[model samples]
Target: MKAGDRIRTVLLAGGSGTRLWPLSRRHCPKQFIRLLDETLFQQAYRRARLHSSPDEIVIVTGSAYEFLVKNQIEELGEEVLHDQVLLEPCGRNTLPAIAWGMRRFADDPDHPVVVYPTDHLIGDGMAPVVLQSVPLAEECLVTFGVVPDRPHTGYGYIKPGDALQNGYRVAAFHEKPDSASAEQHIRDGALWNAGIFLMTPRLFFEECQKYAPEIAEASLPGEYSLLPSISVDYGLLERSGRVAVVPLTVPWSDLGTFAALHDASRQDQFNNVGDAHLFDTSGCTFIHPEGKRVAAVGVSDLVVIDTDDALLVCSSGATERVREVVEELDALHDPTVLEHRLVYRPWGSYLVLEESRFFKIKRITVKPGASLSLQQHHHRSEHWVVVSGCANVWIDGETRLLPQGESTFVRAGAVHRLENRGQIPLEMIEVQIGEYLAEDDIVRFDDRYGR
Candidate 1:
């Protein structure tokens, strides 16, 4: 009962979607990826802000992503508490995630909690719809379904059985189907499951007790790894006869693949999306940073994703098969597909500019008022050069503030750390030289993040 005190919103931020890979990986998933106006997780927070206060929102993410969630929330102009974002020791899918997210709302049984997957992309200003459906949620588990403009084979389908007070009884829930099956499902008056549910702790636990008692009674973060992984659609929604679906006429997309991202975004006359110029190519999507021009002269119906470490060029129809490539690479233990070149840390982030056997170069950025842990490396010595802002460096027993253009050297086995005391981000160039340069070589004395 320590999490969702006076809460109304539960935003699920778990899952590592591989369909948009090269950009999405194990540590950083699609929810945290920068899309249209902002990252999908930020967009979900913006949407959640419509119905609840910052303190009332509960974000559930993996233990490794706690800093990411904190950094993002701080960027949104509000400091987040450690409890606001629940940490999952391991993933147990939606059934356990939702049940655990609803655990701390025991003070108020009928307190309406709207659950949303942070990876979804929905148009803004849809809070009034959830507010209007509160009465229905009090009676039965209310799930939102979007009216599909076309037969979308990627999403699950929901069939409306009979009309309820403000919604309809869920007749049947079908998993993702083939193109032909998807068309038939749409023609039979089925709606695309939006993966958004609104219910209370009372209703949710009651249904879980009857259907999935293991999920209903398990303690999360400790017992989460022991539970079986299953989605809510199969474990609860399809089995519960009291479930209802509310049809929403809004632009909602999971953006599970690059093609879906292109479909949801604004395109050009040639049906191209992102900062890309097409000479003969049409119906393609390119994802890259600005100032980096990506041109396709003689290609068509392809998706080009350019990153610092990896590039993916495949047919637009082959977007769904991106996971296969990731799986193949993962089976080979290819390190290129795990994390991005820009690795996020508790303080800020660091980008590996170049690396070799005996030496490595990095560009580190510490956010304003953030500091690295006091630690020492046994196998490497580091040289820090202040590039943009002020850096408060502590080496051995001496401490000094190095402004821009100043530099310092830290010998191997010396206790040191970097801090940003200025209002702006601290930018520095680090050159590391030694016999071995691996992350595990560091020995921490103290860490604010409890790493």
Candidate 2:
């Protein structure tokens, strides 16, 4: 398969990123977070684009993240030709997602797809590296291996044997090891297993058929019921003999934890990282709000994250165990664990500022030239106060234009749509009051972002 004819891209973007704690929740994971202004997903998308065209790229994301995926792709200016967003009803893990994406491209036997995790941070100028690996991709299942900078027990290890044309034969794949074993593996020249795989769509399915028949069988259309929640590593790569490794001497870090975030993020003079306003901090990672001030005097190697409703403070090394806090919150049925106070949607974003038994106040931001779906609620009435920019409002067969500081009201069961007509972000304060106030109460008619 030629480089241009065979190469395709698959972006796996389904993880919840629970370990990132206050900054990353179920609704807004680490991939969507703007770590240094560019999201991890966007970076991954850019990297993937360097190897394949927009039409050849496939994004596998969960139902809840469909809008975010679409919006991000739009922001990347790739939504014009191919709608690459493949929405999964639910996340069954990497195996099923990969199977689904490969099956989509199975009709074309020549197209080889490179599957990438959307949350990884790779080195600068990765296009040449990816382009160089394309020829090797045709013959074998190529996995990119990061040259281990340290004995990181947080990542898996790859053992390479004989050298290939542009890569090496994969001797074995090792799981996350204990401190001793990890250190030994590092000393023995094992590379960090960066879950980046390149294989033909047909070869991917063929390997699934040989090594992971369960996944292969489940890949059939309308056969999602029997799919087991398994990762691609366990289901295919570990079992496949056709696997190869391409060692990359690149600065790469899977920003999965606060510690990893600290390591990957750019540090200041005081060794502090992130947007948090810090005072007298030497080695701390802070992700605080814009107007919020966080003082860290004489503190080092600490991770501080402050959101609207939750605050997390943990030692940098202990960030791996932060998932336990999410699990604890899950056990308690806490909404904070599932979503932040500021919730994102396809049309706009809404932040719950204050709430009471009968009233709820929210700050909403609608993108310029964007509009909400024509919808109506059965249980709540809404009061919208424009904070900035102009809005074109439609309410119960009446239309009006509202500017900054202007307000409008929609009674319960009234149809409405708030549109941003101006060239700036439309900001509004929304107050809803009635018997019930929930997202599921709305009935959408026409949605631009495809709800």
TM-score (C-alpha) between model 2 and the true structure: 0.93
Q: Considering only N, C-alpha and C atoms within 3 Å, which residue pairs clash in candidate 2?
A: none
Best model number under TM-score: 1
Give me the runs in candidate 2 sitting further than 4 Å from their true place: 1-6, 80-83, 217-221, 274-281, 421-424, 445-450
Model 1: residues with Cα > 4 Å off, grouped in runs: 1-7
TM-score of each: 0.96, 0.93
User: Which lDDT tens digits does candidate 1 get at residues 1-451?
Assistant: 2122333898999888888889898888889978677899988898888778887788988998988888888778887965898988888789888888888676788888999999999886457778777878888899998988998888899999889876899999988989999999999899999999999899999999999998888876678888889988899888998899988887888999998889999989989887866798788888885699777797778888888888999999899999999999999998766789899998999999999999999999999999999999999999999999999999998999999999999999999989999999999999999999877899999998899
Candidate 1, position 231, lDDT = 88
Question: lDDT per model, in order?
Answer: 0.88, 0.84
**lDDT score of model 1?**
0.88
Predict model 2's lDDT versus the native. Answer: 0.84
Candidate 2, residues 65-135, lDDT tens digits: the string is 98788788788886735546777776788889888888778778556678889988888755666667777
lDDT of 1 at 409: 97
Worst 10 residues of 1 by lDDT: 1-10
Where is the poorest 10-residue window by lDDT in model 2? 217-226
Clashing residue pairs for model 1: none
